[model samples]
Target: MTSRIDLTDKAKELIQELTDKHGPLMFYQAGGCCEGTQPQCFEKGGFYPRMNDAMIGLVEGYEFWIDRDLFEYWQFSHFTLDVLDGFGPGGFSLETPLGKTFKIHYRLFSEDELKDLEPVTRY
Candidate 1:
């Protein structure tokens, strides 16, 4: 419902690549070490739970969805999504809606990592 997450060109490219290989992309927020939520992106899966308030968007043909709660959190703050390519091969940095920044590297989820994820639809 909000346009708080600004996707960078690099981010778009990455999402496109994933979508090309898979189908749709899934992005969500989960519990993390900090006060803010941790952003997680994955390939589309079947039987994703329905969230009436999720924010959905398309980035270079890849569809992305953010939980309503996360969307609201970003909307009310100053969070921005930026692609960082200088930190030893770099990755993504989420400038918290509150002005705090968190960096995440690009890596495929292992079988173990996938266990905790819930399915999100593909567009």
Candidate 2:
């Protein structure tokens, strides 16, 4: 089945480093304000997910969640998790301390991928 989320090789390497240092990790993106959302990485349970957040899928054995409303807008897209060399906004993401920012790239799924798109869950 076509998964809803994936990681670039560079992202995979960074995630491995983070896991080695932080144990387990998860990613979240919030869509609550005009400033826009910066994807945040937290040690698993470091950040509590709101009741309406959507769990799109896992990358590197970790969950990627988004605001339920945001997921509604991105539901048809495939997400690729990537990273950049900078401190992310808020300084709350685990990667921020390492001078790295986790980023996401999105693309609309092809007609074929849509036919067997992986499922997502909302809490």
Best candidate according to TM-score: 2
Per-residue lDDT of model 2, residues 1-123, tens digit only: 899998899999999999999999998888856325778888999988889889999989999999888898998998899999976666878887788988889999999999998888788
Give me candidate 1's TM-score against the actual structure: 0.46
TM-score of each: 0.46, 0.92
Per-candidate local distance difference test:
0.44, 0.87
State each model's C-alpha RMSD to the native.
13.3, 1.5
Query: lDDT of model 2 at residue 4?
Result: 91
Query: Which regions in candidate 2 have their CA more than 4 angstroms from the true location?
Result: none
